[model samples]
Target: MGHSRFRRSIVHVNATLARVVGDEEGMSTAEYAIGTIAAAAFGAILYTVVTGDNIVSALTGIIGKALNTSVG
Candidate 1:
């Protein structure tokens, strides 16, 4: 019957999904890779913000003053 076929198809799809994603023991590498990529993206954004023009200019001024004071 069509109903039986549909049920079997659903079951087959579920089984395939489970096999692909249910192996938690072997998923740590994938999890770590994802975490590392996320962390890197976050770090890039943070670095950009910290190194923006205003912050860079402030740091440059401070260092210039310090250097001038030390030299003169």
Candidate 2:
């Protein structure tokens, strides 16, 4: 009888703890939404910079220099 009561008390305590601690499912959804927006904005900015004439010409110059280097 005493052991049975102790077991029930343990179950009750666990239930109470679960209620207090809850879950992070909602928080995870919100965080993912914000992160996705930020990543998309960053990607748009990067695409603009990479596609500019200045960046293209600079990269072309760098590659040209590397390809033309004479072996010592």
Candidate 3:
């Protein structure tokens, strides 16, 4: 009786583990949603930085300085 009970417990544990492993539904969708939101937020930040006056002025200044250099 003790041996039979131990075997039954092991079978039950295995079945539970199998069910958990098989239940990977919608995980990819959740990951994609999170990735998309992160990308959008990053894009927004970059757009703001690039469109700001300071960054534009700095870029223009760099280009002007580069163009004004005289090569011997």
Best by lDDT: 3
Error of 2 at 50 (Å): 1.4
Runs of candidate 2 exceeding 4 Å displacement? 1-30
Candidate 3, which segments miss by more than 4 Å at Cα? 1-26
- Residue range with the least summed lDDT across 10 consecutive positions in model 3: 13-22
Write down the RMSD of all candidates, one decimal each: 18.6, 21.6, 20.8
Instruction: Please estimate how well model 2 matches the true structure, expressed as its whole-model Cα lDDT.
Output: 0.64
lDDT of 3: 0.65
- Full-model lDDT for every candidate: 0.64, 0.64, 0.65
TM-scores vs. true structure, each candidate: 0.47, 0.53, 0.56
TM-score of decoy 2: 0.53
lDDT of 2 by residue, 1-72 (tens): 255774575565555445434554555655556555655655665576679898899999999999999999
